[model samples]
Target: MKYIVTALICFIILVLISSCRNDFGFTSSTGSLKFSQDTIYLDTVFSTIGSSTRTFKVYNRSNDDIVIPRVALAQGTNSKYRISVDGVPGQVFENVELLAKDSMFVFVETTVDIMDFTGDTEFLYEDTIEFDSGANLQKVALVTLIKDAVFLFPERDAEGIEETILLGTEEDGVRISGFFLDDNELIFTNEKPYVIYGFAGVPPNKTLAINPGARIHFHSQSGIIVARDGTLKVNGALSTTEELENEVIFEGDRLEPLYDDVAGQWAAIWLTAGSINHEINYATIKNASVGIIMDSFNNASNGATLKINNSKVFNSSNTALLGTTASIEATNSIFHNSGQSAVVARLGGDYNFNNCTISNYWNGSFRQDPTLLISNAIPNTEFTADLTAANFTNCIIYGDRNLELALLDDGTSTFNFKFENSLLRFNDSSNSFDGIPAYDFSNINLYNQCILNVDPLFEEVAAFKLRIDNTGGANGIGDPASVTATDISGTTRSTSTVSGEGPDAGSFESSDLSGS
Candidate 1:
């Protein structure tokens, strides 16, 4: 009897150990808690004068169905804090379970007392709500903080009026919402900087120029359209390391792709003719329609001179830089992983680059014009550039053809196209011009000085990105010679040396050109 009792005790201990081992950070299909965002950033905090609201996303990264028990304010006050459980009332616990890979959100409302609270928090505030088992609880904090200076517009009231905010009320340090005015003119002086959505809508008769370090957000369909006399000048800055590589969620995309990820849902700063000059410097425009577009429908042919320097356009749709009849001078910039062509020009447009790097792998079709098998597609149907009129010199152009570039049957030609002392390459079968041969280029010019094999050595093309390594001048070209950003595109660019004789062949120079 004693031996049997001892055996029974041993068996029980073994069972208990097994159960404990199963409950690791890993959850079973039968447990609770779900989360999509591994982390969330309030970015900053608001003051006591008013408040701000940001979404705290929840996702069920697990395959099980979990429930939320109770949602409460954990050490946070009512004025500065409030969270809704899936937009529900009364803290109902039954409905918060997130399905596998499904999405739900928690709304965090913050009110800042402008006259009262004045402080900042470098770290995000954190708390927890009671969650039932099986609920894959993944939560990120949503915070709103006060700033040193905020753009407050004119408040509406019956009695008095000192000033009106240029960007209206709803956009007070929050999201972007506005009308798509195509025929209106907008002017922003020193004191009155127009609060804008994205840089996609350069409406008719409107010209917009942003001051240095002027903050703008492209949250929704915020972009620009340059109507007659409409122009846009954006002067942005080099995002800090913590802020430079960002992650965002698109409508039809996954949770948040990396900074270089391209969903190709690009919007553009579309420029029409007779617009004012656009000068953009030291900025970052990511995940827009198109990085910058010069519409080709204008008859005046004077699309506008776009000066770009020390900029970066990442993960956009086809054609990072699209121009028509516009003189573009871009230097010390970078363009990579475009869904289509990195740069596209039409209607006698000019593309001049120096010490820039550009790369793409979108068959160069979407890079320019990707459509059905229409006989009159832009590149294949009719392509012409007035070389004496069009200028693409002292730069690098690369695509997925390896070092050998692929040419569309109806693509632009090198007519009076002066490529002096530049390197050009493609990734075709021959690795030369013959490997990718299906075009009519009777009008062209070339000055391939020290250009290695006349091909663009793209280390990673399938990924729609490029790394120009001007090591041996064999595969990729780095900026070695001094390149000027203001030369071709007339952009006020930063000075930096490129690696290859082909030099940095795209829109960006990776040499820390800011010298900071």
Candidate 2:
């Protein structure tokens, strides 16, 4: 009796498996398919480069299972756009099935050459994705903007080896790949956009000047390196309108809007040891491993110099402004949204920030470092140097973390730092950080009339709008004499409707608070 019962159960399981596999009663779709969107805008794409993959859903709302007789691009195989229906990628598909009340996704991407079009430098590329043929057909539009750009990359030799220069070797004997920029590439103009691949090194004694309205895009792992004795000058003027017409912008080559806030898309602007006389104004640098690295080889006696004004650097995987034994003076600048600290002064440095905003609201991962970190000693190393001067005046140093400022001294070097009339975010909830000597908020010499642990009430964090409202603690409490006359947006800082009636701390003076 037991053997008979077990055989019967096996037969029932087989029948259930066969029933599940037999989905043969599918009816032809009668143009009743619904889509997630009627059109998909692929954003801007550089010539000869592919676009980011975009997906949309096709829903089968009917009760009966449906079979799409045909699904294809309107231009067929000749179309520059590519589509993948269900799990199959091709110009067309036949007999695609969708269960009742189910949905399937269609992925689309494109790579078009600008030369294929007419005389225009930028043109619109458009096509349609067809769901079915004839009277029962449904269509979805596809659009992309293609722009012509100047591409700079290393050439390959006869032996198949690409051109490369030496960026110092590692302790493990591995050398970093780089290439020097050509003489003709010294001056980047606004006539066209520039795209760089690999590390482009500036030759010694030469200067790379970028003019106003210039857009520089870097491919993955690519960046610019200023060699010893080299200089980089970004001469961008304030824009007359909101379009930032005169600002020099540096970002990754991915033109998709989805990558706008993504960090670490490329490398950094490396001002190597001995590089000097660097200046950046009215610039925007974003989405890099490290936005800018100012290194003087840890030689306190020979520090690199960078005078930056009216600039913004953010979305860095590492620190936005990384200074190692360098001298940096910044005015009306903004640094925010970094994976680690927004600003890091390590191994000692001479740094000064006036009317700047250093806020790190990094949600990409668990951030272990503070928004502003200053240390005279390298971690787990014997290297130590003197902190000549680290000063912050009329600035906002705040973040999502409890302690946005950290000062570490090995006690072997001069840790000279001061903050005046600024707003800081330091909340030692557990009294863990209050015990440290650097947390002595009552010290008049180091902390002078600085607001602590108050919400700045930013307009929007994700949109990079650091402007504060009337309720912001940074409003009208800044020392007018120490800050810039005009804010980052060219707004005058002296006038305010807020009660305190002074310049507002940070790179921005809120128009809502400052009645201007």
Candidate 3:
């Protein structure tokens, strides 16, 4: 009987021990807590912009529920990074419980000021997420490259209110205002990159000259506006020795490779009405909502509203060149990868292109518009304007879409255009263009001296190299008199043995073939 009583006492002690284990929390002393990743890498974040939230799962692999004594950043509250544990935001957390066979989430985010750190144009930040009493630690490798730029923003008053100004005329005024540069700030040199926060306007009768090798970066929805009677002259020239240097660059402020082709990061270079004598030479403008917006204000006495030569405008979210009842002449230029038309002349405008390549192969999104569009009316609006003239000579207009050219005439105004000695991509399998009188290719006067649906044989489409190959059908099809002497890259156009002495039909001349 005594032996049986001792056994019973041992059983009671065992039951008590099990109950105590269930009642008390287990400390994370065994280092058995596992994480989804040992290190969370936050890639290339812009200065002053919060990064996308990243998540890491903390799993309790052991048999018992473990309570983390402390979960905090190594730098405590002084760190730039921020973390949230189970939806609770804090730099330091204690008594975080993880049930057995369960997992909890930790979300991380950060916004670092570039000027606050020191290094190259890009700065790197590091911190650790420690668990318990610094016994178990998981590192979050934070690295960012801060790009220094000339910030151009509107002045704020004592109450932090931005100033305003009138954008348009009294008749059709756009009461929009932003930072306006004075005479001293009108020049943009190559010393440093310029970052515009809002619409940077050039005062009336003033000229904003951008020197060669100047890099202009724009923030979201930011751009440069040439006010009425103002001139924007981009004096970018090709270096005699350098292949791709000395050209002025206009793009979004993000320098990461991931944002290289991201469109709509900023607005356009707006050329308001009465703004004349504007020129862009050897400039690279890309990744905007609209590349160049030439408003409907024509100086019949002055030259075209703007003249672009040996330049490139591509990867725009909307139209690359939107000329609304405005005059524009572009030569030896390239326009491509637009969400809408590469070149859109709406409500009448005098537009001309010579030896220019306008291609739209935008696969980024669902593109409903063609590459080249000419309309005498605005859709869904009661407004209708005349299309004065649109002439393309020695040019190549092609894209992945079936119809790369759309000419919509409202039948009220004059709609006139001509394609001479050019390669145009238009598929009439469904009679979309042939049935419409505005796009009737059968009319020799409208579509005269042009090649239809023929490949231009671009060297590389993905690289944005629209140069025609030596054996391309476009090579030597252009008229020598109509084509430019040199291509956009200053290379001499190729001479074809079949078509006699003439250059290719695009902006770029193929270096694979020799010309005599």
- The number of the candidate with the highest lDDT is 2
Worst 10 residues of 2 by lDDT: 296-305
Model 1 lDDT tens row, 156-232:
36776432213324756432323444333343232312233343345555666555544433334445556566667
Candidate ordering by lDDT (highest first): 2, 3, 1
Assess candidate 1 and give its TM-score to the true structure: 0.55
lDDT for 116 (candidate 1): 50
lDDT of 2 by residue, 159-220 (tens): 98888866666553434566888899999999889999988889999999999999999999
Give the TM-score of each candidate: 0.55, 0.88, 0.82
Q: Estimate every model's Cα lDDT from 0 to 1.
A: 0.47, 0.89, 0.83
Pick by TM-score: 1 or 2, better one: 2
lDDT at 29 for candidate 2? 94
Better of 1 and 3 by lDDT: 3
Name the Cα RMSD for model 2. Answer: 4.7
lDDT of 3: 0.83
